[model samples]
Target: MTPPASLKLASHEGRAAEAAPGPEAALAIRGLTVSYGQTPAVFSADATFPARTMSAIVGPNGAGKSTLLKAALGVIPRVSGEVTAFGRPVAEARERIAYVPQRASVDWDFPATAGDVVLMGLYRRMGLLGRVTGAHRRTVRACLGRVGMADFEGRQIGELSGGQQQRVFLARALAQGADLYLLDEPFAGVDAATERAIIDVLKALRDEGRAVVAVHHDLSTVTRYFEHVLMLNVRPVAEGPVETAFTAEALDATYGGRLAATHMDSLILATA
Candidate 1:
């Protein structure tokens, strides 16, 4: 069955924005909290994500890293405090932001080609009543080429390998053309080559004067992959450059217990 026309249109508009830059953020967040039913996932998280930098949200599992990103986008039901994009409230400025969810969260068997998925990013600009024109198609093709997936436009998403599928989603997010990108676990469960490719795309986005925030796992790659870091575990642990925030003390605070401390000690001594 064909997907709803509205979905396709919304997708296209999201992608169209990628062709140009968006306004910069002034004071992005003050006090943000996200809760799941009675339990709080992210608590009083505050940080300013400057324009034109690559930031990584790093922590152990259940650290509410993903919750923070979702809260910023208003995807989760319960959230408090302020989140602004380009100096405006997030709800009022949703068009300037884009999100790429974790690959494992999606249903690969969903009937959609790579191009169809990429076009979904353009939906915001095209509106529900809009049709996908030749320009949109060309934009989609160019986005695919940018990610080295131009030849896979017609392939079923389910048929692609894990790395290939991840790249497709990244391409879709690139197609969105937003200034602020919120990506969740984009590098999870992929090959080393795929990881490097994803990092390159993120750096390119940063070079274009856009902010890219990603919820990432690999502690080793955090320093190398991102220019800024938000380390979390149910609350704000640290926020700054990788050299400062990724320290032994901060990692212990975010991770808790002895395991993190032990690992951190070794990491510190080795670095010294």
Candidate 2:
């Protein structure tokens, strides 16, 4: 059954959380809560992302998808929570995490070329007084090449198309040489080709024994793109492998009646 364009879900049955021991988790969050003055954004959320896997954080708008990412990263203050990256406190493992924020939140007009942007990712390794060296330039080129933006390194960021800019930002994150990647809506506004390019790089990273997590809004791509999923509606709804957790029941719970009955039916039938 082909669903309407409005219906966006992939077929996957819910499964129990794995009980067997595995490798150390790439990220863990316990009792996470965030508020905006008088209102709570995320409430006592708990999630775990495993090593060498790609996970998607999915929920409806205003469900605190981005809020969860920001709070976990300490970009925004959390009311209560314990977050760990690779079994260590976030502060202690900061260098092992690379973050790519929503493209819309960036200041593209800041006078910098694509190469300059990627070079920023290497600043930590260069130290306070260290200048850009030949090694750094090679690294920058390599990162850009990985994202297929090598030729555009000299282009001003503000002058590029939306997809081009996104690729450059991803290149910058790649230059960080982090073990875990956190991306907030990496595919939000890009052409199919650019989206393909980004996901390919991300999957390759996961295959290399790194972890990748993203605040993903498109349900159609959830099971296809990620191995694990964290469903949310302010608080956690369900979480685990996409094969088991990306079920219609989880979507209904996470969306909280926002998805119509017709849509839900379509999802079930399509998946069935």
Candidate 3:
């Protein structure tokens, strides 16, 4: 049988070479390999995320899901790989990209107010030595409003509850006005209402031609939200449209025998 369309996007071991992503892709990673000391994390991963779409990165625990985002951003070292944002190297395309790390990874008691946090997102656009103008404050307010956090702007970031905090972080990303967004578990620990709020903002971004790629854990919600799926198990298991690539077999390969609890078959229309 032929390999799945998502798996055909590229080769993890370099056996089936694929061409570089074209201009239409908002983010692309090829031959991405990451290692810590002698231990390897991600190996030869490849995938291209097109613009104006939402993509989900899913995998079992320790499957290198978070590694993909950090490695691509160069926050961690990469043994080898090529990462591009709108066809430009990540370092060269910082302004066009926004990253919202897992909320738990940050210390909420950092003393910054919510408004202050969002202002940081505008620094790149304002440039060095450029002051935050009245116009800049207006933009921050608008972004906060978009995330339903307008009333929380002046409050201490740490004082807010879990869902409110996530919205604040999203407001910061909006203030950046990025063309591509990489978010890690934005829904983790958030209430259903907050999750809906965040997903709505993400959908709005996609509608505006921006790419939203997120590391998600709710296997049941992948097809409900993402247009594309990238399944990882220390390497690429599958990658492509959710309709075809997010099959039970593909998920089985990615999660091994651990797939039973999710009842993922109910989420898909059929086996691949």
* TM-score against truth, every candidate: 0.86, 0.90, 0.90
lDDT of 2: 0.86
Show model 3 residue runs off by greater than 4 Å.
Answer: 1-23, 270-272
lDDT of 1 by residue, 99-212 (tens): 899899999999999999999988987899999999999989998888888999999999989998999999888888888889999988988888888888889988988888
Each candidate's lDDT (Cα)? Answer: 0.79, 0.86, 0.86
Residue 247 displacement in candidate 2 (angstroms): 1.1
Model 2 CA deviation exceeding 4 Å by range? 1-23, 265-272
Question: Model 2 residue 47 lDDT?
Answer: 84
Ranking by TM-score: 3, 2, 1
Query: How well is each residue in 1-272 modelled by candidate 2, as lDDT tens digits?
Result: 33221121111101113433343578888789999998899998888887789999999999999999999999999999889898789989989999898899988999999999999889779978898899999999999999999999899999988888889989999999999999999998898999999999999998888999999988878867898899999989988888778788888899987888787666545444
Please give the TM-score that candidate 2 achieves against the real structure.
0.90
lDDT of 2 at 8: 18
Clashes of each: 22, 2, 1
